[model samples]
Target: MLALSHYNSSASPLFPHFSNDSAGKLEARVTVEGVTDQPNFSPGQPTTGGVIVVILSMTLGIISNIVALIILANAYSLQRRRTKATFLLFASSLVVTDFIGHVIPGALVLRLYLSGGVHHEDSNSSDRMCQFLGGSMVFFGLCPLFMGCAMAAERCLGVTKPLLHSSLVTKTRTKICLCVIWLAALCVAMLPCFQLGSYTYQDPGTWCFIKVLSDTEEVDVAFVVLFSGLGLTSLAVALVCNTISGLTLVLARLRRKPGSHHSAKSHDIEMVVQLVGIMVTSCICWSPLLIFGLMTVIHSYTRSIGDDLLQYQTLMVMGVRLATWNQILDPWVYILLRRTVLRKIYLITKCQAGLRGNMLGRWEPTSFPSSEKNEVNQV
Candidate 1:
């Protein structure tokens, strides 16, 4: 139990303070400042429940991400097609991002727990760690959503217009696009440093994030809205692109025009299925947190002071837990849902159908045409 009651009046190292603390232009303060008055300030005691959950989530996420990366690397090496290689490269990058997301933030949380929660002293060193942790959360959290959207768009183009895709999209261009996605996420994460919004330690002192309901309600609302809006938009784009790709593939399969390459069609189907799985996983796992963020900000906008503090805290914690699951479940989408797996399933189903037909033939009399009867007798 660290206990010290001291206040400081210096500019936040992580972000700048507003020159004028007007109603609209409020200061963007980082949560690590030990400001007891702030809504997001840590209570200085680490909850056993929060610690246990973080440990379990971190452990599973790290192991899963590592295995997914290994699987992706093997696939990438085996791929003969440049298009496939590019997709694999994007997949490998997403896994690496998730892996780091778990390792870096998890390590920080563990360190905070071991140190007995937030320090009493308001020092530069303490602020730096919190800033790093918050920034890591933002960067890693957004990368998967953005990456999924990009993958969906790429596959949609490839399936809908192969000639255009081949002519315009290349390995170099894909790599550059990936870098741009990463850069965009990094920029959003660093926005707090520019005083657009602020990062603060959340309840139980286990994690840090954008301040949801702060004194500077306008800035807080804007930042939260920005983060959540980006996530929702990415998910929406992924949804549309995947739907178009899936429909295109289904239509192509239905038509089955002469001279169409079965192998290529199968490849497109597999890719689209995998992309859909990713899109669904992202929506299920991340929507809660993103939506919760939007709601929280909206609620803050409507109400200056919160009436149900406990409820808000509980919801935030639950939202964070759900969002963390995205990384853990993402890799398995590719591992389990693949062309080889689907082929095996199809074979089993076909065998079962054949066996049932044979059993029925032995139990019930069946009539055949004279030509079929003659053919059977000849055989």
Candidate 2:
């Protein structure tokens, strides 16, 4: 049976620290006894299994995000069209942020878990690392969220206000909007760092989570609530706007004539589809975590049924999983939006020597006139 003394000593400082050692020990003994008496009380550690899962998840996520970034960058470099370039630039920004969010922290978490110690040696270092990690999470995560919304808004304007859009949504305007998104995201993320000390690092035996709130009221709860709410609200608004615009475009296409310029219509449909996909994916990945986080904040203020701690932890873990999956799937959106990208891939494959012979292979032979063919043969 696990002793209460050990558990209490190791309890995260972010939570209410129990000072009565005797009482804690007594409670711990009772809890351990009760668990041992139960039929389903298997208390063995699952470190090996957890570590393996972390390693595989981190490795796969890294590889997938790298591939996504490469695909987007390559696509961006190949395109010359203004609209296509704008989409690629937006996609590239998203990919870069997603890469940092998935790869860096993931690797750090794995290392911390495997070593059974944090990378930060002292309290100050730990605090700094915590703030750094927390800030990075907020910055990178929010960038794509806002950029995506801007992309949607631009698309909507392009469709609904074609004449105005031609003048308003110029390359300069797009770049400015993107710049604003990054600045806004950074400002929102760093606000917490200034007021609250670094996020407390807690090892829950399975995964790492930031401890924004401390046991003492050292940080203003209001600031945390306000900033987090603002960030989430912005992301939610973007997602809704994007989804609406995408659906409108799709419906308009459906209502159009069958003989409409098929190529142009198809391209428009593809762009809308890609925007819708990105918006839906972002919402799916982020909403659960945001909702659960809000609930946690509310519960903290009320000091109510702390019994739901386990459930809250589970939800947070699920949220992390959703966020990480975003990195893996981002590449498909780039491919769907960019035509020059597809052409380049085809060209690259065509240049390969062995790939030339097959009829449906990468390369095709040029046809000559019969007269030319005969003259060449006669020579």
Candidate 3:
């Protein structure tokens, strides 16, 4: 009776045979087993607003990431002079995760829009496609989430142990941490496919995920619960890490004995301010999806007695879209907060002296002591 969350899909990728029974086999039967109301999962295809949102998300996300990757890679290539290899590596991991995160899921959403929507019951091929997309969404989406936590932890270390952080968190160490995050996300994504739960259709017709609410055992509630649980836990860790890091910076500044270089002090305070903004924005964008997941399990948020499914479905769209909005905003947030982006632009425009002064003033240096690298400029 519960509609679960947006992660629901029509077939289990790990156990394809369970949903392998042909449509012909069920033709003589009035109803198919294990299949709930497919129609209820998504009331309709994406409306104009939904279509516009996804389109804009995919378009700009691609452009900004491509630019980010280029500038960052170039900066890192000159790493021996600019900063430690550790910062460069972590920055690269984040850009890669974010780019893939946006493109992979964005493509699936596009396919659903193009096909007028689909389900595993539509065909065996379609079944596999949905399973693949559903599994990928979980994997790719969580990669960025975990990476955010890792970064916050790094910042915390920098504030608490600046000297040790520089020596201890090396390139090899950072790579190991990145690997662990990816592997954990992969393992969690595989859970639903392996029969811990199953993916099924969700609203707006284009999306599929592990069902949050269901009347059948084959696609149980445990998987949906697991998905929600992991998501919230990661977010909580990120918040704690960022909060501690921000507070530490604040306290350090307040305790300063004065006579410190005003330029450097002001810059350090700005870096902390920008870092906190990123952490807060990330939470704002992602929290909606997790909240809906929690609300669905507690009780169908707006689907109780005398309530309309349309409104509940509307709420569902808002939550999923809110998560999608994060993918679009991330690169831009990086651009805005990035300390080196303006510097790079300024260097290229020096020949235009009339504009150089304005650009230089606007893009003033706010270097972090942990890594002089501009790409490490933003968390």
**Candidates' lDDT values, in order?**
0.70, 0.56, 0.60
For 344-365, candidate 3 gives per-residue lDDT tens digits of 4544555466564442343333
Which candidate wins on lDDT? 1
Q: Show how many residue pairs clash in every candidate, following the order shown.
A: 1, 0, 12
lDDT of 2 by residue, 187-266 (tens): 76676556553354432422333442223133434544654576577667766666676677657755655444334333
Clashing pairs in 2: none
Give the candidate number with the greatest TM-score.
Answer: 1
Candidate 1 lDDT tens digits, 94-150: 888888877888788777775666632432323777788888888988999999999
Q: Which portions of model 2 show Cα errors greater than 4 Å?
A: 1-46, 117-126, 196-198, 203-220, 335-379
Query: Which stretches in model 3 have alpha-carbon errors above 4 Å?
Result: 1-38, 42-53, 79-85, 119-126, 216-219, 262-274, 298-308, 340-379
RMSD of 2: 10.5
How well does candidate 2 score on lDDT at residue 17?
A: 36
For the record, the alpha-carbon RMSD of candidate 3 to the native fold, in angstroms, is 10.0
TM-score for predicted model 1 compared with the true structure? 0.78
**TM-score per candidate:** 0.78, 0.70, 0.72
